[model samples]
Target: MDEGCDGTGLCIDTGDGEFMEISLHSRNSFERKKNPSQDSGFEDRGSKSKKKGLSVSDFLTRNLFSRKAKESEDDAEQGWKLFGRIPPKQAPDKDPQQITQEFQNKLRSVAQPKNSKKSDIEVMSTTALILENRPQNLPTKDPEEAEKHRQQYEAMVEAARKKELKELKMKKKQKQQQLKNEDKVVCAAKRWTDEILPNWETMKSQKKTRELWWHGIPTNVQGRVWQLAFGNDLNVTNELYEICCSRADDRIRMTIESSEIYGNSETSSEPPSSKESSVELIKLDVSRTFPQLCIFQKGGPYYDLLHSLLGAYACYRPDVGYVQGMSFIAAVLLLNMDVADAFVCFANLLNRPCQVAFFRVDEELMKVYFHTFEEFFDENMPGLYSHFKKHKVTPDLYITEWIFALFSKSLPLDIACRVWDVFCRDGEEFLFRTALGILKMYEDLLLHMDFCNLVQLLTKIPEDISGDTLFKHIDTIRMNIDKKRFNQVLAVNKES
Candidate 1:
C-alpha cells in the first residue's frame, strides 16, 4: 500500500505498482478496471458531478460574500455620521477656479434632463473625491480639463455675481420703498404738526366761550358725546375717547387736565412745586410734559377732542386703566395726525386680539411675556437667571416696567417710536425681539458680570443712549431671534 492510500479498499497502483495510491470511501463499490487511466476518467466524471452538485451552495456563499464586501465598502466610504445621519461635507479648501468649475458642473448636472432621479450622495461623493485627489501646489498648466473647469467656474461666478447684483438692486428698491413709507409717516406727522393741528388751534380759538368752556371741562367725556359734540365724522376721535375713557385712571385724567390748564407757553419765572401740588401743577402743563399734540393741550379742538377720546378710552378699558405709558403712545400718534386719525391708529393697535389680551390686568399677559423672557434668558444667557436668583431679583422687578410700558421708561422716545412702528407693523414678536435686543445691547456687561453684578448693571443702565443706536442694535438682535424662531416653528409644524 502506498502512503497516500487509506485502509479502505478503493486504492489502485500505477504501471509498476511503485506509485502511491490514494483512496476515499466510495458510496458504491464495484471492481471495473485494472488500468489507472481508465479509472481516472471515471474519477474525473465523479468530481465533475460533485462540483455540479455544489453549484447552488457556491452561488449562495459568493452572493453573501459580495454583499458583505459591498456593505463594508459603503461604511468605509461614508465619513463619520453626525446625529446618526451623514452631514453634508464642508466645501474643500480649493482654488477659486476649481471651486467655481465644480459648482458649475453640479448646477449643470442638476439642470440636465433625466428620466431617473440622481442620487445626491453620488454627486456629492464624486465631487468630494475629485477635490480630495487633486494635487495641491501644482504648477498652472492649462490642461483641457482645467480649462473646461475654468469656463464652468467663470459661468457660475458670472451667474452668482448677476444674482447678487439683482438681489442688491431689489434690496435697494425695498429700502427706498421703506424710506418712502417712513417719509410719508413723517410727512403726515409734520402736516399734523404744521397744518392740521394749527387749524384745530384756530377752530378751538374761534369757538364761543361757552363751547370752549364746555369742551375744556373733562367730565362726561364719553365716546358717544365725542361723536355727537365734536365732528360727526370723527370716528378716530370717538375711538380715542372710547379707549381713553376705557383705559384712564383718575391720576392720568387729573394729569391731563392740569397739563391743559397750565400751558407751558410762557417761561417759568417761579420755581415749580415739589409736592403733590407740584404734580397737579405739572399735570396742568400736560401739553408740555406729553407734547406732540394728541394727549394734552389747551385751547385746541384736537386737544379737547383727544382728551375727550382718550378720557373715554380710559374709562372703557379700565383693566389697563390709566397706564401712564398709553399717553406717550397716544402723543406720538397725535403728533402724526388729527386726533380722530390718531385715535383710529390707536384703536387698530389696542383692538388687535393680542394687544387686547395682553392688556387684560386679571389675565396678566405680562406674566406670559415674562415667561417668554425667562425662557430666552435660560437658553441664551443661562447665567442671568441664576445670577438673578442669587441676587434675589424677581422677574417682576425689572420685567414689569419693561413689559407694562413697552420699555417706554427705559428707552428714549424716538427709539420707542420705532419699536412701536415695528410692533404695529409686525405684532407681538417685535416685543420679544425688542427685549432680546435690550439684553444683547448690554451684552458686554452681561458677559462679564455674575448675578449680583448683572442685577446692578441692568438696574444702572443709563436712560440716555441714543434711540437710533438702540433701534439699530434691537433690529440686529430681533433679526437673529426671528430667524431662529421661524425655523423652530417651521420644524415643529413639519413634525406635526
Candidate 2:
C-alpha cells in the first residue's frame, strides 16, 4: 500500500489496483487505536521519514490549505463586510462541552461572596445580561456633530418663541390706538353738539357746521340733529299722534274681526276703506323693511312699533298715504328717536314739496325733475349720458326709485344715512347732484354695460360702494339747480 495526502484527506493505493480516501473525522478512532508501547518506535520511524521526504512539513501544509478553504466558504455565506468596512475575524465555534464549562466559569465570576446579600448578586447578573444581549454592529457617534445638532434645535425653538411674542405686542398696540381714536371722535362730537349746534340761527359758523354736516353727523346726537334739521312746521302734536294711532288700532281691530270699518267719515262703513287698505299694506311692508335688522322682523322688539308708526302716518295723510318705500324712511326715524318724536319728524319730512311730488308719483312734477337731472347729467358727464341714450336707458327708470326711496334701498344703510345727512342740510338741489354723482362714480362701468345690465346696476346700485369715495365724487359735481330754480322750471313746464 502507498499513502499520500490531498487538501481534504489522506489517499491510500492498494496493490489490487483500487484507491480509497480517509476522512479527517477518522483521526479520533485512529488515536484510540494507538499503543503507548509502540509510540517510541513510530516516533523514531517518523523522524527518519521527515529527514528523507519532509513528511511533517507536507502534513502541516495540507492542514493549512484545508482550513483556509473552509474559512473562505464560511465568509462567503455570512458576508465579508460590516458597516461599510471589512469586519474582524470571528472566533471559532465551541463544542457543547466547552460551552458548558465557559458558562460555569462565568457564573462563578459573577456570583457575590457567600456572605454577601442576594440583591447584589441579582443586580450584577442583570447588568451582565444587558451587556451580553446588546447589539454589536452600531457605529460610534461624533461628539461635535451631535452637539451641533442639539444647539441648532434649541436656537430654532427660541426664535419661534420670540416671533410669537412680537406679534402679540403688535396686535395689542394696534387695538390701543384704535380705542384712543374712537374716544377722540366721541369727545369732539359731544363738544360740537353741545356748543355750536344749539345757537345755529345767529351763528356765522353755520358754513363750518354745513361743512361738518357734509362729512357726517356723529351718531351720538344724530337724532337730535335730524330733528332740528327737519323742523316740525306741520304743527304735529303728541295728542295728534295719539289720536292717529288710536284710529289705526280701531281700524286694524275692526278689519281683523271682519266687521264694517268706517272710512274718513264715521258714517260710511265701506269694504276696507283707504285707511284699512293702508294698514294691510303697512303690515306687508313692516316685516319686509330692513330685513337685515332683527328689530324690524315680525315679533321683533321694534316690529309692532314700526307697524303702529306707519299705520298712524297713513291715517294722518290719506292724500299722500303710506307709499311702498315709506317704511324704510319711518324705520330710520324710529331707530334714532322715540315713537312720538319719530311720528312728528316723519310727518314733517313727508311734507317737504320735493318729497310730496315724489311720494304722490305725480307725472308732471316727475317729468320736470327728470328734465333737470338729465341736463345736469349731460353737463357733468356727457360720455355716460351718451352711453345711457345708446342703451335707451331713461332717467325715469332708475331715478324714480332713487328719489322716492331717498336712496335707502339702493345704498347700504350707513351710507344712505350719510347721504340723508347731506340731503337734509343742502335741500332738493343736492338730490340732483347726488344722482349725477352716482352716475359719475360708476361712469367707467356704466359706459360698458347694456340696457338691462345698466338698469339693474343703477336701480340696486351695489352695496360695496365706498361711502368716502361716493361722497368725494358727489362733492366734485357742480350743479346750478337750487330749490327755487327747480320750482320755477316746474311752473314753466306746467304752464306749457
- Relative to the true structure, how large is the alpha-carbon lDDT of every model? 0.50, 0.73
lDDT of 1 by residue, 84-158 (tens): 555676876899999899899999999986754333112222222222224677766567877788677667666
> Which ten-residue region of model 1 has the weakest summed lDDT?
48-57
Candidate 1 local lDDT, residue 443: 71
Candidate 2 C-alpha lDDT tens digits along 341-424: 999999998888778989887888778778777877877798888999998999999988877778887889888888888877
Segments in model 1 whose C-alpha atoms lie over 4 Å from true places? 1-306, 318-320, 447-461, 475-496
Residue 143 of model 1 has an lDDT of 78
User: Pairing residues by index, what is the TM-score of model 2?
Assistant: 0.61
Clash count per candidate = 37, 0
Give the poorly placed runs of model 2, Cα more than 4 Å off.
Answer: 1-184, 259-273, 481-496
Listing every candidate in turn, what is its Cα RMSD in Å to the true structure after a full C-alpha superposition?
A: 30.7, 26.2
Clashes of 1: 37
Reference-based lDDT, residue 486, model 2: 46
CA shift at 264, candidate 1, in angstroms?
Answer: 30
